[model samples]
Target: MKKSITALGLMSGTSLDGIDLALCSFNNKKSGWSFRIEASETVPYSAEWKRKLREAENSSARDILLLHNEYARYTGEVINRFLNGKTKPGLIASHGHTIFHQPQKHFTFQLGNGTFIAAETGIKTIADFRNMDVALGGQGAPLVPIGDRLLFSKYDYCLNLGGFSNISYEEDGQRIAFDVDPANIVLNYLAQQVGKEYDRDSLIAQSGKVDDTLLKELNDLPFYNEKPPKSLGKEWLDSELVPMLKKSSLPLPDQMRTLYEHIAIQIGEVIHNSGTMLVTGGGAHNPLLMERITACSKAEVIIPENKIIDFKEALIFAFLGVLANQRQINCLAAVTGASRDNTGGTIHLS
Candidate 1:
């Protein structure tokens, strides 16, 4: 195994917030795995690019294929700009923009072609981190648990509040993880309805009151009752969740407030009566959401420094690249319900 590795991780989440780039270094020592975020930034997507990506899911096959390469080239260009006068990484691992994720159908797709990224960046690249797991009957999600187990063992639970809220933790000597519920995806959509990008500090939600009827309806959704090894995607949100919210006919602020309560309840159920829970991701910055989660779960929630809150997922993706490069187990079968633990990611050598 390599003693040390520096890699750049790129992540484009479902919220269409931006592309997160984390340049991280990993060191393998006798104690365990240690890491440092040498540099990190989130390059927000332009209106045109956001529209293209948002509409890509419904586009014709030819158009989707074209956008895939176009997005990859664009990503490479962004990396080039980000790395200007910075340390050039040994590897680049991209989670890509998730366009279609349907593990139940035994397939998933993330845009941004690895070959194009490698070609444009002139560096070893790793992408397509989920297809193999889906092929093995896995959800192809919550991929950061392995990092939680190895790199963040000190925390009892690691909850990431990105486009969606997912939790990872050790249980019975195995890493268990799954999507909890919607987060920024739903919130951002509602915010956009009012000409805002997102509910800053969850102010919109805090200003409104939770409708018990809506909250109850959301809480009773069958997805929440499902067991672990399950996941969610844009399709599910569009088909199941979005319609429900629309049918309620409540005011937008009430919808946002009720949704926050619903999310807190679902997460509370998962981490009920637990130890310390480390919260990260963009949602961690939302004071109201954090307060609701704290009130519901009764778990001591610890929000780390700003860097970790915003870039932990990207940092872990870089770690995933390091493990994949070494042919070590990066995706856990226990967490993803794959046929077996496997090294996930396709290497595109430059």
Candidate 2:
């Protein structure tokens, strides 16, 4: 493949944090597929934009469509600002901000318009990576496993703590992945209540006491009892999680601490509390949470370099674009329970 391919990847995760942009170079060598992050940055979302995205979860059909195009334009502008005069990559791969992801209902939708992105940036764009798997009677979630299997197979487990926490690992000669539990989504919401963007190393949670009752309730969530090939979404958060948290009269810090411990416990259950695991995502930066995870589990959680922690999702989305262009399998049926392994994504020509 002509030495290597450079692609720009954009990720608007469920965390309502910001858009992550990574310009990555990929090479398929005799050894295996490898990638290098040439440049990357995260443009934090404005309060106004974040409010619109959160509210769009239940907005009218027409409003959702308008927001889709508006978000695409916003994404493109953010990319333009980040690129600033740097050379454009060959392709743009985006995991558009998920406005709705109800796989059980047989539909999933991401907000950024690929056609609009392509037109704005004058680069071919690939997005909407989840719909096909849902259509195939699969979870249509956790599409990142293919990249985990191909790019970071050295670790026994790959855990990402973003808006939500999800894990991927090899099992019985097949790659398995699924959401673990809520992470930054809930944490950030609580932080906002205290006028902070996040817990800042989870100081809030660390300084407080974990309410045992809340911890028990969180651990008892029915979603945890489900088998593999499952997923979670904002609907679950609103309908199941938020109301439960609201019932607690504990202070915000105690609530954060309880949930943090709960997240650690749920994650520990998956790894059986042991293995060499690679942890990445914005949540990786929370030293307090990381410490709790280590204390609760026997797993060796290795937090990688900063760029890898921040932009790995973006890099993987870019790899998905490369695979989609080549008609290669980028979404694994074994992971998402799709009818078959499929090359996910739709290409929008420049």
Candidate 3:
């Protein structure tokens, strides 16, 4: 029998939609791992859970710590049931829920207890993959680029339309990635104003014309002017975007329209013309937004297999965990502007 490597990669994206659990089998050489996604599901968060996570940043330190262990145990329980006690994975690689991320302050927090997970599940785990980079003066972000570089290198670029629009591409042998702009985050916020979670196929956006004033202001935000190795967070949106949009008093459709275009321009500027970009994530389902991106950049947008669209982040985080398990360099200096290219992640045993 061949040696088998089974991994369960967990991701809780910015959308706050739910937890994406991906089980995959890796059986091959270091550069030639063949993976078949065993089973996957998006366990939607309850209304109460969503509310707590959405307001978690402003909550007390004690509550955040409590939630940290709570989430960790919840994750372990989920994994246990997913396995059904039938099989045990070689590794549990978690991209734990991000609660606080402020690289400038040299502090970042992702709340899921790997140690607690190991203790509870009696399974080896690796997690908290972002803090060390920040401690070393790095953005501790876009860690998926390492996975992009290794697993999906054939494409010129990989753009994920998750809660936020982010792109990762190779340039002269170095990989680059950053939050392009708000994707579902802004659009969904506008959608909620009209009692919708998201605009299916970007119908609301297609129904309205772009507000030039709003579009121009969004394009000129100081964050856009920053070169690279930068990222966005809920805090920035709360402080900058929400207030600006609320004060604009523009119709919701116009806000969605302008925000969609803003995301297009933000992403379009980074990818080269005519380059093939493998686009994925829930936002890839947005036809109007994809149409705008194609219009803005004139690039070839390719959506791969449905599984890839829905679970690529979870898959790539699995790859990141594998690299970290091997004690290899998984975060790049060029990408996150870290002081050094570092092997990041902590491991916990049963």
Candidate 4:
């Protein structure tokens, strides 16, 4: 295995906030793995791109294919601009925008074709990191746990507050992780109702009152009751959660407040009585949500610096690429319920 590797990781999360690009270097030693984010930036999606991605799932096959390649080219262009005058990374690992993720149906698709990425950027690229696990009868979701276990072992629990919130930690002798609940995705949608991109610092939610009735309904969601090795997707949100929120007839602020409470409660139930939980991702910026989480859970919540909170997922995806390049396991059966531990990326040479 190489002693050190520098890679650029690109991540477009479910929240549609932007494409996060992080230039990172990883060093492996007998003791453990360590990493540094050399440079990072998030290029926000334009209105047109956002609309296309939001509706890609419902588009025709040909249209979806076209958008897939177009998105890859766009990603490549973004990388070119991001890399100008900077140290060029040896590889590009992209967690492509997910168009559909239904592992139970035996398929998952992430846009941004690796071939196009490599051709455009003229660098080795890795993409499509989830389908193999799904093909192996696994959820093919929550692929971040291996990174959490190896790179963030100091924390008793590593919780990411992304488009959706997922928690990873060691339990017994194995790593345990699963999607906790919807976080920024729902919050952003509610904020849009009020002509805001997102509830800044969760101010909207902080001012509103939580509706107990709505809170109870959200708490009783079947996904919350499902066992670990399970995951959630936008499809589940649309079919299960969206309708429930739509029927509430509550003010948007109240809905956001209740949703925040619901998220806190679900997370508290999972990490209850734990020691320390490292929280990152965009949701960590929402002070009100953090307060609610601290109020409901026993664990001490630690939010790292802004760069980490914003770019941790991109950093982990880059680590996943490094592991794949070394033929090391990046997806764990204990976390994703695959038949066995596996390396899960398709390498596209430049």
Candidate 5:
């Protein structure tokens, strides 16, 4: 490895909050390695792009392709603006926005085009991190556990409270991970009803009553009954969750409250909820929801520094790109249900 390398980590999660760009420097010293985040920013999405992304689940195939190309260009512009032509990084690692994630069908799509990123940025790019795993009969979702195991193993377990909730932990010394429940995705939908971006700190949940019936229905969803190596996307939310949420006559607050409990319960059971649980992601900002999970589980929810809590996945995706460059395994067998641990991702040379 070079004495040091700079990485521009980019992420746009399901929360639809914005794109997070982290300029990180990694140094390998005699004592292993350490990373220092130098500059970072959350680039809010334009309203047009936001609507298109949220409504992309049912978009026409032609439109999906069009958006895929457009989004990749948009991503490149964002990265350039963030860097201001400063030090050029060795490469770019983008967890392109997930457009369709259905591993059961043996397919997944993260739309931002790697070729476009490479052409626009004139640097090597790595993307499409999940499809190869799905092709290998693995759950293409929850790909971050590879990074969780390699980069943040100090914690007994790591849970990302992102657009959806997922956990990464060691089982029998092998990394195991999967989606726990829908987090900000459902919560933010309800929050939008109240004319806000999200339930700021999940205060709305604290103000509402938990509808037990709705909670029961949510917890009983077939996805929860299924085993790991499973994942959920907006399509699942629209097909399964939206109908369930719509069938209930409950008001927005009650809906949010019940959904909150569902997330808490599913997440609690997935992880023992014990030991140092390194929780990060946009949903980590949801205090009331976190409090409820804490009340239900005997786990120490450790919210790391804001940069990590917000952009850890972006950072890890960048790290995954590095591992790919080194021909190291970036996909864990136990985590993805693959036949073996594999290095999965497409690399684009400048």
Candidate 6:
């Protein structure tokens, strides 16, 4: 048996939701690894921070660098507040906010300075988990599958509904995972048009009707037919998805309903097999969207407790940090199409 260690994981998803912090303890037994969530919280982004991140994709190089350090300090401050009076974790693992993710160009950038985080918090930090995979010609994404395989293998599928939807499962003795479709990214975009932050359980979507034409167009998207190991980025949404949505003349509610149906159809097509699928991420909270998914598939959707639904990614990142510290394989080649299975993450010591 391996000695148990506690670690704090920080996640800033593309949904621009907030910084999710999860403190978890992990132990490795002969059977496998097991973990318990000690605590978790979300620090919502201020309007200024949100706007800066939203525009980061277009920001100048100097500005990007400045924002990177600023965000790192902000993350450290959040961690400091959350950890006040708590037992200190052994490590801090951060999945920094993604500013650019064009793996095809052999580049992906997640902005949070690990050195700064470690300096500010006086804790060893691990971050920038994707660049090595991209350098090895991989998608460097959907990295959560390794956690699913080790921690939640009972389910036939594991799906995360964050800014985008991604699924992971075993096939022919290897773990396979990839981005499925846009989820909260599109939903939140439409919700904002109506002066709301998000659709809130997809209530706005449930109140309207699905547009067949829009559904068909969404279904016909070329990326959907691409082979596995592919990932989607904000650039794709800005260049292709949002533009297509703008072409439609539907009302806000109707657009939400139509996109909701589209997301369901895309996800259903991938996991049509009959078995239990563990669902997490912000999208799991959308009951109406969940209904749409159930209506279109044979699989049973199992949503765990609220804490699991909201902070699974952060917990997994913490687990990934544990693996990295041990020099164990954390990122899988089968999932990312990298040259080989390898450990990926940069560590910073204060």
Question: Candidate 3, after superposition: displacement of residue 196 in Å?
Answer: 1.6
After best superposition, candidate 6 residue 34: deviation in angstroms? 0.3
Backbone clash total, candidate 4? 0
TM-scores, each model vs. reference: 0.98, 0.98, 0.96, 0.98, 0.95, 0.99
Q: Rate the local accuracy (lDDT) of all candidates.
A: 0.93, 0.90, 0.85, 0.92, 0.83, 0.93
**Cand. 4 Cα-lDDT:** 0.92
**Against the correct fold, how does model 1 do in TM-score?**
0.98
Give candidate 3's TM-score.
0.96
Question: Which stretches in model 6 have alpha-carbon errors above 4 Å?
Answer: none
Write candidate 1's Cα lDDT for 8-110 as tens digits. 9999999998999999999998889999999999999999999999999999999999999999999999999999999899999999999999998998999
**Top candidate by lDDT:** 1
Mark the regions of model 1 whose C-alpha exceeds 4 Å error after superposition.
1-3
Write down the TM-score for model 4.
Answer: 0.98
Please write out the lDDT profile of model 3 over residues 1-350, one tens digit for every residue: 46867888899987888889888876657566567777788888888888878888999999999999988998888888878845577888988888888888888788788988888788889998998788788999888898887678888889999988889988887898998888888788888888887898778988888999999999988998898999888778888888889999788888888898899888888876576899999988889888888888756889898888988888877777777888888899888889999987899988
Flag the better candidate by lDDT, 1 or 5. Answer: 1
Q: After superposition, how far is residue 320 of candidate 5 from its true place, in Å?
A: 0.5
lDDT-wise, the better of 2 and 6 is 6
Q: Residue 25 in model 5: shift from native, Å?
A: 2.3
Q: Which scores greater on lDDT, model 1 or model 6?
A: 1
- The better-scoring model by lDDT among 3 and 6 is 6
Full-model lDDT, candidate 5: 0.83
For model 4, the superposed segments whose C-alpha errors exceed 4 Å read: 1-3
Against the true structure, candidate 5 reaches a TM-score of: 0.95
lDDT of 4 by residue, 141-196 (tens): 89999989889999999999999999998888899999999999999988988899
